[model samples]
Target: MSEALLDIRNLELRYGAAVAVRDISLQVHPGQLVAVIGNNGAGKSSMVRGATGLVRPSGGQVIFRGEDTTRLPANKKVARGLVMVPEGRLLFPGQTVEDNLILGAYVHGGIKTPRSKATLQRVLELFPRLRERLHQQAGSMSGGEQQMLAIARGLMAEPELLVIDELSLGLAPKIVDQLIGVLADLNRTGLTILLVEQLASYALAIAHTAYVVANGRISHHGPSAELARDPEVMEAFLGRKKTAA
Candidate 1:
C-alpha cells in the first residue's frame, strides 16, 4: 500500500482540566478528500488545531510525509506545504484581496517562489469572482466572497495538504454548493484535503473517507459512501430528522 500523506496516531488534547480530544487516530492519503464531521464542542476544532500545531497534542504523534511533525511550529508546518483555511474567513478587513493573498506566502521567508504567480492565477481562475474584486477590501465583499478569498489565500501557499474548517458555515445553500464544487475540483487536481465540516451530508458527498467525531472521540470511521448509507452514522452526525430518506 502507498504511504499515507498524513497520519495522526492516538492524538489527545486538553484544555485546562478537561480533555478536548482523546485517542483520535486518522490517516489521510495523497489525492484524497477526508472529512471530519462533528457537532459543536465535539473537539473537531481541537483536532485541527493540534494537527497544525496551534494547540499541542498532550500525547500521540502527527506524522507528515514520513516525518514526526508533532512538535513542529505552525509556521514550519506551513512552510512544509501544510496549510489551513481556518473556521472563520479571517481576512484582513482593511486589506485588499490581493494583499491578503500575498500574506499567505509569508511563510516562505518573504521570498517569492516562481510558482507564486501561477498559483494566484489558478486560484483566481477557481474563483473568477475574486479576480474582479482583487483591489477591493475583503471586508466589503459578501460572506460567500470572503470565504472564497479565504480558501484562495490558502491555495496561494501551494500546499501539499490543505485543511479546511467549517466550510459551509453561515452561508446560503447555493454559495455552499459553489464552494464545495470548487473544493471538489481542487481535490481532483491531486491536492490532499482534510475538510472539517458541520454538515455531514455535504461532507460525505465529496469525501473519500469520513470520521464522525462526538464527545471528543471518533464515533464512526469508514468509507464516506458507506457512512452516508448507515442509519446509525447518519443519525449520529446528520441528526435523525435530516437523515430520513
Candidate 2:
C-alpha cells in the first residue's frame, strides 16, 4: 500500500481557555478522498486551520510527506504541496480571476514558469466558467462561481494533498452537485483530498473513508457507505430515526 500523504496525530487547538479541537488524528493516503463531516462549530474548520498552519495547534503533530511540519508557516506548507481552499472562499475582490490564479502559483514560481502555466490551463479546463470570466473581477461572480475560483486557485499551487473546508456552504443544490462532481473527477485523477464538510451526504458519497467529528473530537469513522447508513449519523443529519437496514 502507498504511504499516507497527510497524517495528523492527536491534534489540539485552543482559543484562550476554550478548546476548539482536541486529540484529533486522521490520515489521507496517496490518491484517496477522505471526508471529515460535522455540524457547524463542531471544530471541523478549526481542525483544518490547525492542519494547514493557518492557526497553530497547542499539541500533537502534523506530518506531511514523512516530515514534521507542526511548526511550519502556512506559506512553507504550500511550498511543500500542502494547500487548502479555506471555508470562506476568500479571494482578492478587486483583482481579476486571472490575477488571483497567478497569486496562487507564487510558491511554485509564479505564473511565468512553464509548470505554473500548465497548471493554470488545467485549472481553467476544469472550470470552464472561470475561463470565460478570466478578466472579470473575482468579487463580481456568483457564490458558486467564487467557490469554484477558490478551488481552482488552490489547484494552481500543484498540491499533493488538497484540504477543502466547507465545500457546499451557501450554494444552490444544483451548483453543489456540480462541484461535488468536479471533486470526484479530481480524485479519480489521483489527487489526495481531505474534505471538511457540513453536508455529510454529499461528502460521504464521494469519499472512500470518513470521520465524524462532534464537539471537539472524532466520534465515529470508517468506510463512507457504512457511515452513511449509521443510525446516529442519519439522525444527526436528517433529524429522523433510521428505518432502513
Candidate 3:
C-alpha cells in the first residue's frame, strides 16, 4: 500500500480526568474508505477529535501527510488538507447555504482565487440540491438536505482526506443510504475517507477496511467483508441477524 495519508499512533484522549481514547492507532491510506464503528460513548468521536486536532490528545501522535500535527488546531489541519465534517451538521443557522460553503473555503481565503472558484463549482456540481438552495438559509433545510450541505461545504476545502464523524446521526435510513452511496462514489474517485459511523452494517457495506470500537478501544480490525461476517462482531453489535423461519 502507498504511504498513509493520515496516521494516528497510540492516540489517547481525555476529558479532564476521564480518558476517552486509549492507545488507539489507525490509518487511512489514499483512496481507501476506512470505517470506525462503535456504540455510543465508545470513544469513536473522541479519537476523531484527537486525530483531527479539534481536541488535543493526552498522549501519542497524529501524523498527517508525513508531518507531526498532534497539537495543531483544527483550522491548521484544514489548511493542511485534513478536513472533518463534524458529527452534527454544524452549519451557520442564519447564513445562506452559499455562505456556509464560503466558510468551508476560509482556509483558502474564501473562494476568492480561481482555484477556489473551481472547487466551489465542483462542489455545487456534486450536490445540485445545494446549488438550487444556494440562496436558502442553511438552518431552514430538511435534515438530509442539511447533511448534503455539510458534505458539500467540506468538499469546498478540497481535502486530500475527508474524515466524517457520525454520518448516520439523526438521519433516516433512506437518507443514510443515499449519503452512503455518495461516499462510496467519492472513494472510487480517489478521495480518502475515514468514516466514523455507529451503524456498522451501513459503514461496512461501503468501507474497504473497518475497525470495531468497544469500551473506548478497538475490539476488532479487518477487511469489511470478513468483519461483516464475523459472528462475534455481528452478535456483539448488529444483534444477531434474523433468518427466515
Q: TM-score for each prediction?
A: 0.95, 0.96, 0.96
lDDT of 2: 0.91
**Over 4 Å off in model 3, which ranges?**
238-245
Candidate 2: which stretches are off by over 4 Å? 238-245
Instruction: Between candidates 1 and 2, name the one with more favorable lDDT.
Output: 2
Error of 3 at 91 (Å): 0.7
Tell me how many clashing residue pairs each candidate has. Answer: 0, 0, 0
Per-residue alpha-carbon lDDT of candidate 1 for residues 111-216, written as tens digits (9 for 90 to 100): 2676787778888888899999999999999999999999988988889999999988789888988889989999998899999998888888999999999888
lDDT of residue 222 for candidate 2: 98
**Which whole-number lDDT from 0 to 100 does residue 61 have in model 3?**
96
lDDT of each: 0.88, 0.91, 0.90
Q: Model 1 segments beyond 4 Å from truth?
A: 109-113, 238-245
